[model samples]
Target: LPWHTTGKLSTNRVTSSCSRRAMPELLQFKDASSMRKYSRLQRQAGKRIALVPTMGYLHAGHMSLVQAATDRADIVIASIYVNPTQFSRNEDFGVYPKAREEDHRKLLAAGCAAVFEPASLYHPGTVSSDGAGDNANVVGAGEHVVGAHETFIQVEQLQKGLCGVSRPHFFRGVATIVAKLFNIVEPDVAVFGKKDYQQWRVICRMVRDLDFDVEVVGVATGREEDGMAMSSRNALLTPDNRQRAVCISQALKWAEEQISHREATPSGIQHEVTDRISTGGGRVDYVSVTDAENLQELKHFVSGQEVLVAVAAFFGSVRLIDNVVSVKQAG
Candidate 1:
């Protein structure tokens, strides 16, 4: 297995080299059985495993996650699968960017011990279709297919509001797939990015509530030099749209500043964020200020309690999300 170095990742706090040891040859697995077998073997050998689950099209943000995993575990395994259950029929799952070979090279350089590239984690033998196939199981709207993946995990209260409000099926797909990954990988630790703030909280809640034996680690959101959050979907942004996408981060920062200065209501901050993003040539999907831990939508800021200011907007057809956590101080 020849691993090519593709230069250093441009993510915040992430370097190309693994802190623990030299890069090892990356093992690739395409099916669940083989990946599970390997994980079992690693455990038998007394090696602690860490899992970083991702969709293909690796970027600096993903590399940051890999770096986090490498630091904590003896072996790091990154799973790349574009889950169909997460996206709605109107969403852009069909056009999601993918660079399998490039992703492998990047993960290898980032010190991932292996890459799990399962074609269909849910459907076993059949390939996942592009017609929102997971929706049938997620919402129970259509006739059940014989042997189709029917089981789904939902974090109920935590899945409400934020991205979950708009993309109703999104968290269901995320929680389910991540649970599947936890079982299959059986790693000592699992790493996730906080850029998807709600998703991170949802997974945390799922793990705690279900009592899974894996430690879930949430890494800080990796940003570009311009402060735009890194995401695979950024590949879909045209140059002009990409530039305008900065408003998402800008709005989040502004909200943080406002909350830190004085008492502010969630509605006022949401209005301002919505305005900023809309004026910056983007369509506002949602802007929410909620309790950081429970994700309950807050009416007013309280002293010393952290609140998450999150926004999702569309730059052209690409939807980008960003968030900032702020704690108000008592005057």
Candidate 2:
């Protein structure tokens, strides 16, 4: 639990001396049009709004983004939609962890003003008026619902490689939903975690190329005390695999040290990392270094060049990813 507050309590607005301070009202909206109307009102009133888009099952990493939002804006709206498009047919879309009640509590505790939770933004037909299913799509005029949304935004160049190699449809889903959120929220700023480094870069480029008048800020990745990158999937790791999973981050740290203090070849470093995680009982997906900005694979390290050493592996059915970004400084 990342329960943290930055500013002091307002002395002017007092409810009771013994009573604890009240949490912000957590408004929930299932319609994008309603959310847009609320946001429009906020903007008209001279209030600056910050948007933190997320799939539910909130964690410290997500909370950190909300904290960043509150730090910058007058009000913060957190969108919690488990995007179905981002998950392929074989992926864990159906089984992905969800904690609606707990997530609501956490967001309210974290000072989030409201939560935008539509049943299906892409495919509106998946959800019914009774609210019994998984989908939440936005219906258009004539009450005719789109069965499955095909029109989507794509960040062409940035989505070519890296995680894109494995999860082909991931970035397309991400960009499309995020663009929708930006339009609906009409936020002045949006905060994204850098743990998904490629996703963050792709979104930054999308905003620039598409002319969305929203400033996208990439916040540093939040980590656990043990150094493993915090993710929703961590809970699925078996006890033994959970302990061994530390090797993913350890490999990145080891590679960073070798690059910084000793002469290191990209291939040599990758081989060692692959061996380290493999011997630890993890099935390697990819262990490679690439140019940070373009995500082009690197052959060797050069001074003044920035690179990201990223790794993804599976321990059982759960897949994990971690990375260490290094810049070889120029003299």
Winning candidate number (lDDT): 1
Model 2, residue pairs in steric clash? 119-135, 119-136, 120-136, 120-137, 121-136, 124-137
Candidate 1 local lDDT, 292-329, one digit each (tens): 99998988877998989998999988999999998887
Q: What local lDDT does model 2 show for residue 144? A: 35
lDDT of each: 0.84, 0.80
Q: Evaluated with TM-score, which candidate comes out highest?
A: 1
| Candidate 1 least-lDDT 10 residues | 5-14
lDDT tens digits by residue: candidate 2, 161-217: 878888888899899999999988899999998888889989999999999999898
Compared to the true structure, candidate 1 yields what TM-score?
Answer: 0.88
User: How high is each candidate's TM-score?
Assistant: 0.88, 0.86
